[model samples]
Structure formats: structure tokens, C-alpha cells
Target chain A: MKCGLVAADGAVLHRETRPTPRVVVDARGGGRAVLEALLETVVELGQKAAADGHRVRAVGVVVPGIINAESGIVSAENLAWAGTPVLAELKAAIGDQHVILAHDVRAGGYAELRQGALIGTTNSLFLPLGTGIAAAMVVDGSLVSGDGYAGELGHTRFVNGEAAELCACGQWGCLETVASAAALARRYGVRSGRVVDGAREVLELLAQGDPDAEAVWKEALAALVDALVMYTTLVAPTRIAIGGGLVGAGETLLAPLREGVAARLTFQRKPEIVAAVLGEEAGCLGAALMAWDSITDESGEQTV
Target chain B: MKCGLVAADGAVLHRETRPTPRVVVDARGGGRAVLEALLETVVELGQKAAADGHRVRAVGVVVPGIINAESGIVSAENLAWAGTPVLAELKAAIGDQHVILAHDVRAGGYAELRQGALIGTTNSLFLPLGTGIAAAMVVDGSLVSGDGYAGELGHTRFVNGEAAELCACGQWGCLETVASAAALARRYGVRSGRVVDGAREVLELLAQGDPDAEAVWKEALAALVDALVMYTTLVAPTRIAIGGGLVGAGETLLAPLREGVAARLTFQRKPEIVAAVLGEEAGCLGAALMAWDSITDESGEQTV
Candidate 1:
């Protein structure tokens, strides 16, 4: 992805293009190959940028799954890597420069907190319901990593009925199984025997008032509301930023969801539910911020 | 309830019984009369302890609902308290002593994390499923109270088909309505016209092979497992401590619930489910710890 860095002070500086590395295919091989590949890509990009007269002080990599930021270990289920020393690899590739590795959703959440829907909000939950369900937390002006395993919202169980559908994580009735974009398509296929390509088609069908699509859409909305209600009850953040492929439904998803959650809350404060402003640029922006943080010293100020 | 505190180091302390004050009713009248009474009791107890030559440096009070520790404001639907300045009131009554106010479940969780079922575990959830469901998080030896509203687990929605039950919180199909101890009793009343006094009687009936009791019990277990499965996917805790009224069912509850959760979890690590060790005393013990922390100086050593 070719991306430009936007500083906190609204200064635009430097442009770089780097290939997103393929995630590990096998759970074995000890993550050495995957880490090596990631390092090589960053180094190549850094060299190109430097030759073009742009100084690249740091590199940021976003990965899916559990991450221990303090230990620099990535434990992503989708990736074949577990406990891979990503920080060391990035440093070895770029040589003495800073490297920041963060959970993709959390990084996205940072983008939202800084420049998007969650701006000026101290407490918020950023959940991206895509191929899977995961979330990020920004509490008291700081993102909570909790040893790099803070936000995993998708796996919470949403259904208590029989195991009609099994989640990819092997859990039955997980919120992800019912609320994600993939779940919308799967539910449609199960009910009507037509395999849709993505959640967008289902949304289009629902807009046209297709009964099957409407039913599937409502089900997914209910599931999403279930998770959000629980989150509201627990954290009661000032706002909740919904992103990822599923959120592309936009107001079609946001309006009813807000109403549903509002109907549930009585004494608890109702948080504003809004669409993410960062769009697809969230991860890259968050990476840049983290990279900036890496180079800064003890006063905790980021000078990019 | 008259209570005794056992410190983390196994030192036992006693507080003599006295009637809770009636003055709090003047500040907020009616059903909240009990809460005021409890607060008054805490103040009276603190004064008496000081008069008895015990150096009481801090006071910890645990209440139900959403609490903001930093601001000392409490909001609980069940208690009908919105923005109650509990810490201020207690501080006024108890003189210069530091007052620590915490959510009841989180306090219970603190007790478990320090000395009970969750001992030595880095990440654990303490759930007290009584009149309502609330959870406490202990991550890496620190209690996670995201703005003091981090443990409201009962509000998580539980969707099952189209027939959704309305929750007391005004939400439809909340997990508490289906899985809490009160929920079990309520289900028994609706299903078989049996007015069970509490979850204890319902469990008794289930043990006696009563079909209605068995059905309701199974439903509760399913709902609980569903919620836990979702929680595990997100936080991936090392253990989950089940406390409160429902946990009184003991092995009967823990055994089947564990099996159910394990069966549902496929890719995630299966956390051990167990009964809380501190039992009824968890809240008090936890409060004391919080009180101790409030008074302890910066060197990380306790003076009281």
C-alpha cells in the first residue's frame, strides 16, 4: 500500500510504498520465514525511500490476533506466527532505526481516536467486524493493550440457542458468526441456498426489500447490538466507532443499531455510535503515530 | 450483614456489628434507603475502629452498578443511584481517612485475584451472577476498571430466534434475563407455575430430576457458556471465577458449565472455570485491599 504520513500537527510529510506481506500459511516453521519476509519488505521500502531523499526513521507493521507489545511477540491465529520476535526482525532489517508493531484493529482505533470518529473522546471502543470480530480500547487518552490482548470483541457468544452454525474459531453462536460481513452472506446462503459474494450484495438486496436479505440483515444487526449493549454496559465509553467491511453498510447499519442499543439502556449513559472517519487509511495512520512515538523521548511527546 | 476482614497476609480483623445509619435516606429517599444505611454503617464502623485504638487509615466501600473510581460517582439501575457522591459522603463521616469506593463485583474479583481461585493467574474474570450479572477484570495483577464501568456483563444481549425476552435494563434478550440466578427462578415461575424462592430451590429441583427445573437449569448453563465463550474470545483469560448466588450450586454448576464452554471453544484457549474462594467475604476483603492501596505511599509499601 502506498501511503503518506500525516503528522499530529497536520503537517504532511514523506510518501512510501511497501507491499503487505502474506501472512503465515503454516502454524509451524516457528515464524522465522514470516518475520524474515516482513523485515525484507520494510528494508526494501526504506532503501527506496532513502534513495528518493526521504528519511524514514521508523516502520510500523499491523498484524491480526493477540500481540504482546511489551515483548514484541505476535500471536495471531490467522497468521502462522506465534511468539515471533517481530521487533528484533524489523530492527535487523532497517538497521538501528525504530520499529513499532501493533494489533491492526487497535492501530485503527488509534487513528479513530486521533483523527476520526472518536476525536476528543477519552473512553471508546473501536470494533471492526470484518472476516472476524475484534476491538480496540482507548481509555483515559491512552489505548489499552493489556499485554497486547485487550480487544477481541468478535468472539463473545451472542446466541444461546443450539449450535446452528459453528464459528471459524470453533465456537458456536459467536457474535462474529452472526454479525460479521461473512456471516451475513452465510446466513443468506443457509436460508435461501444462494451464495452471495459479500455483505454489500446482501445490503443491496435488503435495500430492495428482499425478504430473505432483510431477515439476514436484521439477525446480524441484532447480534451486533447484543455485543454493543454488553460493551456499553461494561465500559460505557463516550463513543463507539464501527469500521471494517461490514460497516460499509453505513447509515443502513448505524441508524437501527443506535435505536436498538438506546432502547436497551435505561440508567446507563448511551454512547454515540458513529462511522469511522479514517476509512482504509486508519491502520497506516496509526502506524505512523506509533513510529513517531518510538523515536520520541521521556516527556512522552511525539515529534515526527 | 456483619462482616470480618482477612488480610492478604492471612491476618484476621473484626468489626463489631451496629445498625447502618438512617441519615443517608435524607440525601436520597426510598429504595436507596438501604444504600445510605450501608454507607452510614461503613462510617460508623470506621469511627468505632479508630476509637478502639485501631489505626484505620482508609475505608473501602463496594456497591452495585457502574462506578467511576477517579470521580467517585456511582450509577446503578438496581440501586437507583445516579451520580451518587459516595466517597465524599463517607469521607465526611469518617474524618480524614482515605475512602476507596469500588464496584461490588470488581471488589469480589480483587479478592479472588489476590487470595482465591484466581491466585497466580495473570488474566482472569470474576463474575458474580446474582440478582444481576456483573464482571471484574484482573489483568496482570491490576484490576481493569475502564472509567469504573468495566464489569457490567449481564447487559450483554443473548439472541435466540425471534422470541426475545425483555430485560430489566429495558433491553430485549439480555444475558442476565436468561442466565442469572434470578432468571432461573423467574423461568421456573413462568414455565411450571412454580414460585421458587431462589436459585437454590431451583437447583434442588433439578437434582431431584424435575423436568422443568432441569430444562431451566440447562438453559441458564447454555446462556452462561455462551457469554463466557464470547468473553474468552476477547480477553482470553486464564481462569473465570463464578461467584454470587448461582455459584452456590457449586460442583453441579461448575462441572457442566465447564464442559459446555470447552465444547463450544474450538480455536481459543479454554479457561478454567471454578468457584470463588472468598465466597460471601469477597467484597469486604477486596474493599480492604482498595482501602490499603489508597492510603499506601508512593514507595509501594503499606503503612497501615
Candidate 2:
């Protein structure tokens, strides 16, 4: 877990990374271990912040899952958390601090919107091509929560016909199945009949003129272009910030998308495609920014 | 044009159909004729309402084109209106009344949301399969305008590969190219080598067991299913209200959509597919409702 103590003025005073416990699905109260780890991390971070002469007024916790806003429960496949009382657990761990629970991608997008590449955009998209693909859609200056059901752009189908593959989400031919970081590595292995380190090795192999790596990269690009075109046509975003692991490839990943979406569009407004600025710390920084915003909000004060 | 005056309590106080003046594109001040006709209609309607002991408060004007919120200009190709100052013109013609300009399809969706098929939905879609396809997206209990560029669902690409037909929107393989009412009639004529009257005739031929009608109908259904499934996966609406002339087919259209959307959905929430209740007069009613709401707003009062 990457976390930090951020001042109200958006300065990071302290930072730390902690190992997340492996979620055991078969163990009794399997999700409890994950929750406990999160609670410990937050509590320890709060203590460290205080030790450094800081007063914590609010806390923001973001996770990758469907966050039920009203019930304050979460359900994540990887975390083995099925409607776990996460908000209640957080309140129990840190008494009386203003808490905000949000989706990781949306929070990251919020940080980008407030301070990073996507600043000043009213309608924009923040897409992270990580191990799993998800989107944070900003519509008319607000992040679309859809009650935590929105921004599953990665799960939408893009690959068509026989080339379509079944996704981990039980859907056929989802964008995540072909375009995500994990998919790039997995598809490279299946295409080349050899295991590579990850998307990093795949990128290196492409740079070295490997045919298998080229094919897999091309496939991911095609699906991603299709997804972007569809999103542009439907939602009409003026800017899109591409982030996560695959964005590490830099111009190699962005150029094709810009060109392909441009070629496909006719009446729709073209979006400025840019790389995300914050990298891995985006989500953590966003959480802190949100917590600070909450503190200001609780005091019923406005900030410039 | 079907027009109506609706009471604040959702009652139809008055209704009528008026002949629209044919736009003269080559004449001096070409689009002005149509604008004049609309002005005359609104003025006459207001006079009639006052004659019947009703007080005029606000005016709502909706059209089938982009409504530029900032400039209050409209540019509809079919209407031969190119950046016409519509809102300003309306205010000049009907002085001192609060004027609202909206998209016609969006107005229909608003009516459906208020008192029709989507009465209680917070997140829903009002899709009309007419001569062209467009969507009125109700996300988080509010209609999403996307600055008038949004809700062109018809224009989104659906047909894949070599068989993709070019849509009038300049995009190839759009949902409207195959799934719209005009598409059904056009495709039917092309298939049977006999020009049919319209989609109504195509429906009749289907009932009579014509192979050509069955083939075209199946093709339309397939593309529509693709569009709906894609929308459901991306937006997560709780219900979908299908409107326009095509909904006249009733069960023949809705049952298949419900079944197909249900079958295609995996992790996404399944939206209830139902026929739109308000029919052709929905836009007019919605305009009045919005006008009434605006009056409430101007008076600083709340309405149920």
C-alpha cells in the first residue's frame, strides 16, 4: 500500500509503502485480514503524522471495488470482500475523524482533476491500463459515481468476432481481456510460448523487434483505440489522461490511440490524450487531498 | 408538430398539432421562416391559454439539434439552422418570460422520467428508435446534457467488419445505420426489391411471414442488442425506456430486447426494458413541465 500525510496546501510531509496481506478466500473471515491490515496502516500513519507535529482532521480510504455509498459496504473479487462493513470498521479503528470512502480510480482521477494533468477539465476521462482496467469518468466537472457502478469502461466489450476472449469478470471480449497490463503479459506468453517478466519485458522485447511482442502490443492498441473511440462518441470528453503500467511505454502507447481515435471520429470533438503525471502515488495523494477537502467542508468553509 | 399545454399537476390542459412551414434554404434569410412560424405558434398558444383563464409564466422550446448553452444558439442540419440565435430570438418575440431551449429527445426523456415509464428511476435511459437514434441519459436522477453533444447513441459504431454501413453522421457502422425506423424501411426495400411505405409496412410484412422482412428485422434487432448491451455495461442504468415510432411494434420490439440484454449482461446491472408511455406528445408535455418548474424556481418555491 502506498500512503502519505498531505498538508491542506497539498504538500506531502511524510510517505510510506507497506506490504498488503495476501487475501485467503478459503480461510474463515477471509476478508477480515485485509480489513485489519488497512486499519493498521491508517492508524500507524495517523500516529506518524502526529509524531511529526501534524493534526489529522479527516481520513480518506480508497479501494478497488464496488463501494455501496448508502450501506458503506464493499465487494471486491481480489480482496475476497463481499459486502464487508468497511466504513464501520474504519470508524471503529479511528474514532470521530471525518471519513470518506471512494473508488481508487475515481480518487486518482480526482487528484488529477484538482492538481495533476486533468486540472481545469469539466468533461474528461482518466483511464489506467493496470493489471485490471477501470475508468474514472468526469462529466460536467464532477466524477461520475453512478452509486459506485459507473466507470467500468474496461469491462465493456471491444474485441469483436473470433478474436474475442472471455474476461475474468465472466464477460466475453471485454477491453480488459485484451488491453490491460496483465493481459499484455499474459497474451505475450500465449503468443510466444514463453513467460516474460511482465509488461516491462514485453515493452523491451518490442523495442528489440520481437514479432510476438509486436503482435500482442498491436492487439492491445487496437482494443484500446476502439474503446477510446466509443467513449469519445458517447460521452464527449475533451481530454483523457492515460495512466497505470502500460503508460510506462510512453509514446509507444499514446501515439496510436491519438491517431486511431482521430481517424475514427467525424462529428465528435477530439480529446487531448496525455500521460498521467502522478504515476503510482496518484491514488494515495488523491485520498489525502479528499480528506483535506472534507476537513474544510466540515468547517463549512470554502477554499480557493 | 404535436404541441400541448400541460398544467403544473401533470394534466393536459390543451393539445394540438400544427403544420410546420417548409424551410426555404436558398431564400433570403432562409431559416428565418421556420423561426417565424415557431414564434407565431408560441404567441397564438399563449393568447389561447390566457383566453381560457391561464396565466403564462415561462416558455420551453425543444428542437432536434445541438442547443449551445453558452451562446443559446442552435445548428440543426435538417432545419437548415446554422448557429441561429434561438434563445435570444425567443426572448425578443415573447418578452420577459423565462425561456428554456432543450433537445427534443431529451424533453421526451424528461417527460418519461417525471410521469411515464421511468417514473421512479434515478439512473435510466430514454432511447428513441426513430428516423434517427439518440439517447436521453438520466444519470444520478438528472438528465445528462453533455453540452448537447452527448446522447447521440445512434451515431455510435455497432456493426463490425466489412458489412458495416455508413451512417448519415459520416461514421460507418453506427447503430442508426441498421437499427433505426428509417433503416428498417430502407433495408427492407433494398432486400425485397420493392419499396415499402415505411417501418409500419415492414412490420405488416413481418406479420405476414415475409422472409425479407424477417431478415431485416433480425439484423435491426442484432445491432440494437449490441448497442443496448454496450450502454448497459458502460453506464449502468436501472431501466431503459424505448420510445419513438418503432415502439408502436410493442412486444415484437421490447420482448427480444429484454431477453437479449438479459442474456448478454454478465457483471453489469440488468436494466428493465420497457416501452415509453408518453408517445409523440411527450416533448410538448415535458416543455410545459419544465416551464412550470422554472416558474417555481423563479418564485423561490418548492414543488413536489
Candidate 3:
């Protein structure tokens, strides 16, 4: 878990990381342990902020799951949580400070939009090529939440026919099936008959011109390009920020995407493809930003 | 062209239709003639409203084109317009009245959201399968404009592999290439080796169980299913209203789409597919609604 204390001026006061407890789904109240851990972390972080002579005004928690806006419940597969009253529990844990819950990717995109790579873009996307892929879409100057169900671009189909693979999401040929960081590493191992150290070693082998690495990399790129083209054609974004682990490949990943999308488009608006600047800190920073925005909003003050 | 005079209370005062002037693209001033005709139509419509003892409060014009919000320039292929100062011309033609320009499909969607099939729904889609296909996306309680370049769902790839057809938009296997009304007629003719009158004739043939018509219809439905599934996966709309002339086929068109989309969806929110009401007049009504919204917005009054 990545946690941080951010000042009102968008400066990081303190940062820390802690190991997340593995969810034992089969045991009774297994999800409770995860929830308890989250509350403990938030309380400790608040205490640390006081020790550092800083007053915590609000707390923003971001999760990779579906958040029901009205019910304040969350359903996350990784967390082993189903319809958990996360918002109500958080409020009970920390009395009276404003608490904001948001999607991690959308919050990251908010950070990018406010102070990072997507600062000037209104219609844009923040697509992180992580272990599991998802998107944060900015349409007409506002982040689209779709009541916590929007921006599942990674789950959308990009691969078809016999070459397609089944995704962990129970769908076949999803963009995440071929283009996610985990997919790249897994596909590389299957194709080469040797396991490498994740997508990093796969990238390293690609730079050294290994045929299997090249093949898997090419497949990932093809699916990514198809996804990007489909997004551009449908939504007409002017900029797209690529983030997460695979973006560490830099020009190796971005150049082919730019070229492929350009070649496929006819009358559609072409988006500028660029790397995300904030890196892994984006989600943590975005949470702070959102929390600050909520307080500032209550005071009728504008947030940057 | 469908034009109408709508009272502030959402009653239709008058309505009329006129044939659009064909553009001679190779000839100089051909596009200018079309522009002049549009301007003339607006002036005459205002005059008609005046002669009927009702004042024209605003003029809302919707077009099938990319309208650059900053410059008020419009680029529509069918109209032979390239960066034409349409908003400026409309303003010049109608002296000082509020002249708001918008996309026709989006306007139609606004009408649907206000008074037709999509009322009481926030996140939804208004997709019309006309001669060509485009979508009017209602995301998070507002219609998405993307500065007039959004909602080209028809141009996105659906059919792939060797059977993919080249679309008029210069793409291969676009949803428009297989699912559009024009494509339905064209594909039926190609399969049967006999030209049908239109998509209506093809529908009639399908009713009689013609093999060629059935094949073409099946292809259209398959592509539509793919397109709807993709839309649902990404945008997460709760309802989808299908419009255009093909919708006259009613249950034949909607039943298979609903069943196919349901069968394919795994984790995505399944949208209720229903036929669009208001038929062809949707665009005109939406234009009026938008104009009223603009006016009501100025006075700090709620619209719908």
C-alpha cells in the first residue's frame, strides 16, 4: 500500500509504503482483516501527520474496484470485498474529517490533469499498462466516473479470431489479455518456454533482439494500437498519457502506438501520445489532491 | 432539412421540411451556395415564427459535421464544407438572437433525454442506424460533444480478418460498413446478385425468409452486437435507445441486439435496449430543447 501526506500547496510532506495483507477468501470474515488494516493505516498516517506538526484536514482513499456512489459500498476482487460499507467504516474510524473515496486510476488521471502530463488537455486519457489495465478518461474538461463503472477500456475487445486469448475477467480477446504488463510477461514465458523477470526482462530481451520477446512485444503493441485507435475514433481525445510499468519501455512502446494509430485514422482527431510524469506516485498524489479539492469546495474556494 | 419553432413551454408552434441543396464540390462557390441556402432557411424560419405572432427567442442549428467550438467553423463532408464559418454566418443571417450550433445526433439525444425514450436516465446512449451511423453519448448526466468530434462509434472496427469490408470512411471493417442502413441494402444486393430498393425492401425480404437478406441482416446484427457490447464495456450506460429508419423494423431489429449483447456481456453493466420514440423529428425537437436550455441557463432557471 502506498500512502502519503500532501500539503495544501501540492507538496509531499511525507511518504511511506507498507505490505498489504494477503486476502484469505475462503475463511470467514477474511475481507474484514483487509478493511481493518486499511483503517489502521489511515489512523497511523493521521497520527504521523500530527507528530510532523501538520494538521490533517481530510482523507482520500483510492481503490481498484467498483464504488457505489449512493450506497457507499465497494466490491473489489483483489480485496475479497463484496458490497462492503467501506465509506461508512472509514467515517466511523476517523471522526468528522472529510473522507473522499475514488477509483485509483481516475484519481491518478486527476493528478495528471492538475499538475502532471495531462495538465492542459481537456479531452484526454490516462491509460496505465499495469498488471491489469484500466483507463481514466477526461471528456469535455471533467473526469468521467460513470458511477464508478466507466473507463474499462482494458476490458474492451481488441483481439479477435483464433489468435485471441481468454482474459482473467472471463472475456476473450480483451485488450488486457494481450497488452497488460502481466500479459506481456506471461505471453513471453509461454512463447519462449522460459520465464523471465517480468516485462522488464522482456523489454531487455527486445532491446537485445530476441525473437520470442519480439513476437510477444509485437502482439501487445498490435492490441494496444487497436485499442487506442478504437478509443480515438469513438471519443476523439486530443491527448493520451501512457503510464505504469510498460511505459518504462519509453519510445519502444509509444512510437509504434503513435505510428499505428496515425495509419489507421482517416478523419478522426489525432492524439498526442506521451509518457506520464508522476510515475507510481500518481495515485497517492491524486488522492491528496481530491481530498484537498473536497475541503476547498466546502469553503467555496477554487482548487487548482 | 427539418426545421421547427418551439414555444418556451416545449410546445411545437410550427414545423417544416425542405430539400437540401446538392453541393458541386469541384465547382467554385458550390459550398458557398449551400451556406447561403442554410442562412436563407434560418431567416425565413424566423420570419415564419414572426408571422405566426410568436417571437423567435433563439435559433438552434444542428448539423452533421465537426464544429470547432473555438472558431465556430464547421467541416461536414456531405455539405462540401471545410472550416466554413457556419456559426458566424448564422449569426449574420439572424440579427442578434441567440444562435447556438450543435451536432444533429447529439441534439436528437438531448430530445430523447428530455422528452423521449431516455428521460430519467443519466448515463445512456442514443445510437441511430441511418444511412451512416454515429452515436450521441450521454455520460454522467450530460451529452458529450468532444468539440463535435465525439461519438463516431460507427467508424470503429468491428468485423476483422479476411471478411472485413472497406468503409466509406477509409477504414476496414467499421461498424458502419456492416450495420448501417446503406450497408444493409448494399450487402444484400451483393449477396443476392440483385439490387434491392432499399433497406426497407431487404427487411421485407427477411420477413419472407430470403437467404441473402437473412445473411446480410445477420451480419448487421452481429456487428451491432459487437458495437453495443464495446460501448457498454467502456461507457457503462444503463440504457440505450436505437433510432433511425431501420428501427421501423422494430422487434426484428431490437430483440436480437438485446439477446446478443446480454449473451456477450460478462462483468459490464447490461443496458436496456429499446426503440427510440419521436422518430425523425427527434433532431428538430432536440435543437429546440438546446436553444431553450441556453436561454434558461442565462436566466438561472432549470431546464427539464
Candidate number of the best TM-score:
3
Question: Tens digit of lDDT per residue, candidate 1, span B6-114?
Answer: 3335344664444533434335674357566776677666555666566555567887767878788777655557778777777766677677788778888887887
Candidate 3 lDDT over residue span A1-304, tens digit each? 8998887778887888888888988875778888998899999998888877777888989888888766678988888898899999998999987889989999999999999999988899999999999999999999999999999999998887888899877889999989898999999999999998898999999999999999999999998999999999989899999999999999999999999999999999999999999999999899989889878544422121
DockQ values for all predictions? 0.49, 0.73, 0.88
Candidate 2 local Cα displacement, residue A246, angstroms: 1.5
lDDT of 3 by residue, B49-113 (tens): 77777677778888888888667799988888999999998887787888888889999999999
Runs in model 3 deviating more than 4 A are: A297-304, B297-304
RMSD, every candidate, angstroms: 4.1, 2.7, 2.4
Report the C-alpha displacement of residue B246, candidate 1, in angstroms: 3.3
* Cand. 1 Cα-lDDT: 0.74
* Candidate 1 chain A lowest-lDDT run of ten: A295-304
lDDT of 1 by residue, A77-182 (tens): 5567766777777766667776788888888898788778998887788888777778887765677776676676777766665644677766567778888888
Pairs clashing in candidate 1? A156-B230, A157-B230, A234-B149
TM-score of each: 0.85, 0.95, 0.97
For model 3, how big is the CA root-mean-square deviation?
A: 2.4
Candidate 3, pairs of clashing residues: none
- In candidate 2, position A239 carries an lDDT of 95
| Comparing 2 and 3 on lDDT, the stronger one | 3
Q: Count the backbone clashes (under 3 Å) in each candidate.
A: 3, 0, 0
Q: What share of the true interface contacts does each candidate keep?
A: 0.70, 0.68, 0.90
